[model samples]
Target: MQIPFIDLKTQYETYKEEINKEVLNVLSSTQFIMGPQVTKLEENLAKYTGAKYAFACSSGTDSLLLALMAIDVQPGDEIITTPFTFIATAETIALLKAKPVFVDIDEATYNIDPKLIEAKITPKTKAIMPVSLYGQTADMDAINAIAKKHNLVVIEDACQSFGAEYKGKKSCNLSTIGCTSFFPSKPLGCYGDGGAVFCNDDALGAKLKSLLNHGQGKRYEHKYIGINGRLDALQAAILNVKMNHFEAECKKRIEVGSRYSKLLEGANVITPTIMSDRNSMYAQYSIRVKNREAMIQKLNDAGVPTAVHYPIPLHLQEALSYLGYKKGDFPISEQIGTEIMSLPMSPFLTESQQDFIVNAIKA
Candidate 1:
C-alpha cells in the first residue's frame, strides 16, 4: 500500500522503450564523454527554453558555479539570495569566497521577496541570485528592475523550476543568466547528474561554454579558470529521449497539481499559490500545516510519504554561521522551514492515489 514519493519508476516505465534505446546507443557508441548527443541536447534545450544559447554541465551545482564564474564573481563580492532554499543556492556563493547576503521570502510563494531586495544591496553586491523555489519563479520583473538599477547581474537559480514560466517567459530566460538541474528527480531529468546554463548575451554565452569545458576556447586553449563541468554523452542521450515527451509531461504535472489543490480545498491546510502571470511546474506539491511532525507521521502511517524541502534557513545554518546571522534574521524563511511539507507529486500520479493522500491528510 506504500506509495512512492517521486514516482520516477512509473515515469521510466512509460518511456521504457525509448529510454532503453538511447542508453544502449550511448553504450554501444562508447562516446561516453561529450558525445554527439551532448551538442544535440544543448541545441534541443536552447530551442525548447527559448534561450539564445545553452551550455550543458556536469550538475546543477556546477551550473550555478559556472554562471558565477562566467560573470567573474570574485572573493569579497556579495550575492543576494533567499535563505529558505536548499544549501546549494548559498553554498555556491560561499565556495567562491563571496558572501551570500540573505533576504526573506514571501509568505504566499515561498520565494524571495523583491520588495526586500533593494534594502540589502550595497556596492560589494555583484549579483542578485533569486531561486525559483518549489517550481515557481520569484518576482523577476521587480528583481530585474532592481538589478538593472544597480548594474548587477541577475542569475535565476532555477534548478527546481525547469519547466516553469514567468510573465510569459521561461524561467531560465527571465534573467541575465539562468541555471537548471537535470538530476534524475527534477522535472526534466537525465539518468545521472546533468545541468545547463541559459543566457541571451553572446559574450557570456561564449564564456560559459568555455568555462564548462575547462575554459577551452578551442580544443587545447585555456581561456578562463574553469571546472570539469561538461555534461557527458550518456546523460545527454537520456535527456534527448525525455525531451520528446517533456511538454506533455509538463501539462500532466499542471493537471495533477491543480487537482491536488481542488482536493485539498478547505482541508484546513495552506496549498501552493501560483500567480496569474505565470505557471509552476509543481516540482513539489507542498502544503503548510501547523502540526508538521504529527502530520508527517500520520501521512507515513497511511502509507503516504512526505518530505520537507528544507528544515533550516541558510543564514541560520552552522556551515554559514560565519556570515554572522542568527535565528530571527530571516523570520519568514525560518517559520516556513518548520511548516512546509511536500506530498507525493509527479505527472503520473493518479486520481485515486491523490484521493488516498487527501484522505490521510483529512484524517
Candidate 2:
C-alpha cells in the first residue's frame, strides 16, 4: 500500500479553492513585497500566538537573526542552546560572530536540560535560545527563571511548534522573543519560504520590525545593519488561508499522535513522551529504536516510508568544529542522533494507513 511521509499534496487538495483565490488576489494586486496580505498575516499571527506584535520575515533562519539583532547580540557573546536541534538555531548565533554554547538534552523529551543551564552561564552569556524540538516546547518557566537570574534574554526557536502550548500559554509567546517557520511542511506553513518573530514587548517588537527591513527607522534610512528579510506578500496571503484552519489541524495532529502511541504500545521502539503541562503539535512523531538501520530497512521493504529528523548533532557538525566540541561533549544528544527515526505523520493520515505502518513495524 505504499504510505507517504507528510501528505502535503492531500492537504493542498483540501484547501485548493481558498489557496487559489488568495494567490490570485496577490497576483492581481502586483504589490508582491510586504503588501496588505503581509500586514494582515502578521496581525493574525500575533493574535494567534498571544503576542503583542509579530514581524514577518523571509525565512526562519532570518527570523532568528532578526531576534538576535534586536537584542543586540554582539561578537564573542555566548548563547546557550541544545546541540540536538536543527543547524539554523546555532547557525544564526554563529553568523553574528557570537558563541553558541552547547547544552545536553533530556533523553525523554529531546529538549535542552534546563537543570544544566546554570553551570554554563558566564559573564559573557547574553541569551538562552531553546528550540521547541519535535513540536513540543522546552521547559520555559525553568529556563525563564534561569534567564531572569542572569539578566539574560530568551529566544524560543518555535519553528516546529507554532501551534503548541507550554503551561497554558502558546509556545512562541513563552519567552522574550519567539521565532517560527512557515516552511511548506510546518504546522502553519505558506507556499514558499516564510517566517515571523513574535514578542510582547512593544519596544522590542518595533526593533524587530525595523531589523527585518534593512534596519530602516524610515524608508531609505538605515539605522542599524540588517538583512533583506521581508516576507513576500504572496507567501503571507497563502499563510493567511492556512491559518484559518490551523486550530482544527492541530487537534487532528494530537488525535493522530495519540493513536500512534496507543498502537505502538507493545512495540520495541520508544515513543515520544509529552509533558503534562504542554501539548505538542506532533510535527514528526519520531521514535527511538535500538536497531534503527534494520528498522528503517524493514519499513522500506514493507513500503512504509520513514525518515530521520537529524542524523548528526550540531556540536559534531564540521561547520562548527571550530567550537572545539568532541563526540562525548553531549552524551544524550549524540546517542539520540544515531537512534531517532520519524514515521509517516500528517493530520490527514488515515486509520488504515496508520494500521498498515504499525503492523509493518511490529513485524
Compose the digit string of candidate 2's lDDT tens values, residues 133-153: 999999999999999999999
For model 1, where is the 10-residue window of minimal lDDT?
1-10
Write out the backbone clash pairs for model 1: none
Instruction: Please give the lDDT score for candidate 2.
Output: 0.94
TM-score of 1: 0.99
Local accuracy of candidate 1 as per-residue lDDT tens digits, 1-363: 668898899989999999899889989998888868999999998998899999889999999999999999999999999999989999999999999999999999999999999999999999999999989999999999999999999999999999899888898999999999999889999888999999999999999999998988988999888899999898998899999999999999999999999999989799999999999999888999999999999889889999999988898889999999988988999999999999999988888898999999998
TM-score of each: 0.99, 0.99
The candidate scoring highest on lDDT is: 2
lDDT of residue 123 for candidate 1: 91
The C-alpha lDDT values of all candidates are: 0.93, 0.94
Tell how far residue 106 is off in model 1, in angstroms.
Answer: 0.5
